[model samples]
Target chain A: MEHLLPLAAALPLVAAALLPAVAWRRPDAAWGWAVAVGAGLLGIVGLLLRRLLQDGPFSYAVGGWAPPWGIELRFDALSAFSLGIALVGVAVLVFSGRYAQAAVPPQRRAWYYSLLLVNLGGLVGFACAADLFNLFVCMELVSVSSYALVAAGGGRIAALAAFKYLVAGAVSSLLVLFAVGILHALTGSLNMADVALRLADVEARGPVLLALGALTAGFMVKAALFPLHLWLPDAHASAPSPVSAVLSALVVKLGVLGLARVLPLFAGLDWLVLAPLHEGLAWLGAIAIVAGALAALLQEDLKLMLAYSTVSNIGYIVLGLGLATPLAMTGGLVHVFYHALIKATLFLAAGAIIHQAGFRTLRDLRGVGRAMPWTGVALSLGVLAIVGLPPTAGFLGKWYLLLGALEAGRPGFAVALLAGALLIFVYYLRILNAFYFRAPLREQILAVREAPLSMLLPVMALALLCLLGGLFGSGPVALAALAAARLAGGG
Target chain B: MRRLLTALALAIVGAVMLAGLAGLPRPGDPAAPVHTHVAAHIVAHGVEDTGSRNLVTAVLLAYRAYDTFGEVVVIFAALAAVMVVLAPAAAPPPGKTAPPPSPAPAVAPSPVVGFVIRLLAPFIAAFAALVLWHGEALPGGGFQAGVILGALLVLLSVVMGRGLEQPLVPAAAARWLQAAGPLAFAAAMLIGLAGAGAVLGLPAEPAWGRHAVLLLLELGIGLGGAAIILGLYLQMRGH
Candidate 1:
């Protein structure tokens, strides 16, 4: 069962290698090969998930060596993130098949598919890595592919944006490596569990504290937390839509995952020490929520609006975790999946609209709903869900988070949560108004047909999942509680 | 004011870090926790079980080869990224076709420099191989060998001119060479299944097979790394 883990990460990579060479002769079939690899990954991940949950968490020691001497791939609540990440990979790749034709040219499609494969492989590896250094390597695979993917379809602005992103990302990655080196110096082991144990025995809490600070600061940059998020808007907005969907829905979450994995190693510290860190995080989350929404509210381009909204939504998740209650952390965990589904649906629907209608601004895209009603429905549902309307996937995460804030005696954060939701509703309303209430600003929109069935299927499927997930929120709620308990309860 | 704020923030952070670091044991203390636990295990059992006289080799190749595998993939990703960046931009369909691929012109090297590099190239090439082969028992390993080989290629370019690097292996061929590291690592990992050991774990019973696989992996990585280093320099210095 443990052997399946390496295969899940490797299968995509092997395909990534074979794809360009294979597609040299067949261009249309390049996507098919990628989709096949994605499907295989989903299957492998499903079996691993079942084994992981049933076995109540285990670690696979790489090279059959014991911990502290070998790298380990852990199976836990955080690692289960691989399953969700893989699911997103399959959905986005399926959407990209027909949709990619518009954005990426035929000459670059093969390279695009290989880059996608490498990206997914990196995500899976990042989620499962139990050794700190292994995590960094996995992240490099992710970062490099994503940087290239941004500049992929070829545009001057896209190249500039990707370079900006690369600078911020590379700097943070180096900071993470620096922190890991500090921890290795203090603990003498690369395995995360071993590091935690050895640190408990060490006399110096200073290096441990410093490591935690560096790791958190580094990841905050990656996560695009309010202040350090300058690169995100351009990178997410300019990249081709399929790449945008993954970057917005999934990539930044790795930063959150890094915090989840590393910060807990220092949880053994006294409340007085840990409180300020969480408190500071909570403050940052609050500011990010308001600031991200305000910025999103002002964006003229539909895609840019959605990009900024990601920043706001991430604020909500970070705020939930910052509250540091089991219930709040559970809310954050539930948000990870809920937001992934909602954001992916929204981006895919938006991409279809842009591809079919040939407009990116809200004013130009006005009344596009009349021509493409299915995509309109998906877009409306996504907007409503993102604003936390009832009977939608997005409501439950905020509900629990709000409850957690009140329970934690931080009624102020609860107020901030309400304000943030209202802010989200305001910006998303602009989109809804543009789609429905306004008349078509351009006559060309009247000639626009529905997006091809290949693109429409994933959008509607995700929209349907949102409704079902909302209706059956109990199962996810329970799972979230379990994940939160496992994380906060300490290993 | 902004600079003042920045400096203030930096000072606070640095002070906190230094305070925390002071609590740590002195650097390189043999009595430290890191030295006692995992490091101790490797020092004690590395040679006998892993069959690598060098403790670093035992650790890198046998005990934690999986991490090394990931590092291989990371370098491979760098090469792939550089290629995609240097790839020709898409031509508009029917409106305009992409320019035809042109053979890049070679830059001529100075006579003295060329003579010197030509004279020294073989010794470097031979030494790189020795490092690659003796990595198990010596300080030099795949990375060092790879660096040596990359230097040799750089020398070749200077001696024989710019075409020496690209013509030695085409961009198309260099990509395959670059990917060889991860592919070889994967092969090594899958072969470990015969012993039912974890990924990249070699079996003790088949001692020769174990050593042979390790040597193969080192050679593969060294070759792949050398190719990629040269590839990156050439592609970045585009025509």
Candidate 2:
């Protein structure tokens, strides 16, 4: 069980390789194998979490090389938590294979699953990696796989969206590489921990600050920070449902995690140099919160509206980080986990509704609640969570964040948080009203039925988790508090 | 459209040439106050720390191995993406027989061009091998060698036509090989873990283990690089 950490990363990769071979011979075996692999991943993640909590951080050295020389995998509390979110997301997505098969042709289905698994493996690996280079490799793996996955459905628009994503991703990679190079040149190391140790003094230098700036900017773009979020809506909305769920849920969070990791590395730099940057990030977060909610409100297409909502939710996480207090950082980290689960649930439910009902627009979905009660119920719960209603995980994150903002004496940010919550309520209420109160669009309603149990099972499980997470928020809060302290150089 | 593509290609090439020329630093001339210290640090510790005879490989594989790893993954990812996005469309129904392969239009290649390609193939292959084998002691490494091999394949494809090229390396095999590169590196890293109790672990007998690991990792890199380049080339050709 202890030795399983490496296999958690390896299994999906190996399964990815084996998928094409299986599809080549037995096409039916592809989905079965993908499901099995997803199940295996969940099992592995469960085991890893047990080990992580019981035995502290787990480290695996690749190629028998020690730190500062060999690549390393570290499963600390933070990483394990993130990996849990990603693997659980993959598990839920596995249930969507039937829909994917029906929507995409048999020939493309294998490739889609292959890309999906590879992307999943990449995200998991990125979370666990201790080496800077390994993180970069994993980041690219997720990025490149996601681009292909986004375009796999084969439309001219999908292709164009993919191309844009590729260009943006490429630019981000270049920036990251440039930052890594400069850091390596400065510290003579590629190990994140080693670099941190060596860079304690050197981070005050102009070039080091420049490198940090580039890295932060690159990660900010990847996270779809408000002003830089231009590519996100098109990429998410145009992609197939499963792909959209993964993109909104997991891929963007990688950028947020990268920012968190790099922030601590620049600890001792003059606050004046960082002050403007922090303020800028906070301002962007506020704007993104308002803008995303407004944009979502205006969107007629169901998926695009959800996509914009993701951009908005991400703003809260970033805002928590920018506050830079211990409580705020913990809130930010907790949001990463809570948001991944909640957002994935919401997106999956939305996908299920779209697939069954063919409701592309909000107006088209009139009184869908009466037809598909389970999906509607799950969606309503997800929306309630997103709106920061009490006893929901979303509320806990916001509560912590609002408290942190108040603690940091940022009353303005607290106001933004309050406004954002109200906006979420309004939009979600609009969705609820359309689903439950309005008259049914008869033709669309007739086509709708309860989503497949496989799909509903994952959605319901996650929806229930939104409640569980809020009820038992202390466990994650404790872990996050520890990680935040470590990140702030106190631990 | 052809003219526009040609113009765009030429502009990109021209810009690259200008950057290359403009960015070249003068030999032994310290450009900045910081360069003096950096130069001294490199001179003092570079050779001793990195076992590679070639300073570039030492810098690439040893000093900055992480960047190289990232680069390798990036290329692999690009290839995987291309494969996923452009997988062959569904086969026609059973009752509908597929159309026959298009007849090759014989446009005569220039005799001089054919001669150059034929003459260059073996030497290019040899040079690529040399670069790969002597990477630790030369200006070139796996990436450069892989590119060279890919360039040779391109030359062969251009001279011999697509049919012959397909036989040399089939699409399926190319995809497998591309995947094999990173997997191979990962395998080598895993092996390192077994020997030294960690991935990317250099054994206590650094000379033997490091050399073996480097060679194995490079082989993966070469295969991956060649396959990805070929895959992209084929995708562009609408294969």
- TM-score of each predicted structure versus truth: 0.94, 0.86
User: Which ranges in model 1 have alpha carbons more than 4 Å from their true place?
Assistant: A25-29, A105-107, A270-272, B1-19, B92-107, B111-120, B154-166, B170-172
In the predicted model 1, the residue pairs found to clash are A188-B34, A206-B20
Candidate 2 per-residue C-alpha lDDT over A1-491 given as tens digits, one digit per residue, 9 for 90 to 100: 54566566666765675576567667777788887888888888888877877888878754433566556678886786655555555545565666786566565777778778778878877888787777888888789888888888778888898889888888888888877877766665677887776676452355576577778878988898888888899999988887888898889988888887777667654442565767778788888898999999998888898899989989998888888778877888888888887887788888889888877788898888888999888898899888989899888888888988999899999999899889989988889998899987667685688998878888888888887789998878887887778877722
Best-matching candidate per TM-score: 1
Off by over 4 Å in 2: A1-10, A58-61, A70-72, A203-205, A270-273, B1-71, B88-123, B136-141, B163-167, B203-210
lDDT (tens digit, per residue) of candidate 1 on B1-239:
99999999999977987787787778788988668878899899988878888889888888878778777777777766766666666655575653443445455667888788888888889999999999999898898899899878866754654642335666566656777787788788888766647778786666587788789789878988898788776665545
TM-score of 1: 0.94
TM-score of chain B as predicted in candidate 1: 0.88
Lowest-sum lDDT 10-residue window in model 1 chain B? B98-107
lDDT by residue (tens digit), candidate 1, A270-340: 53267788888888988899999999999999999999999998898889778999888888888887888
- Report lDDT per candidate: 0.83, 0.75
For candidate 1, what is the total of clashing residue pairs? Answer: 2
Q: For candidate 1, what is the DockQ?
A: 0.53
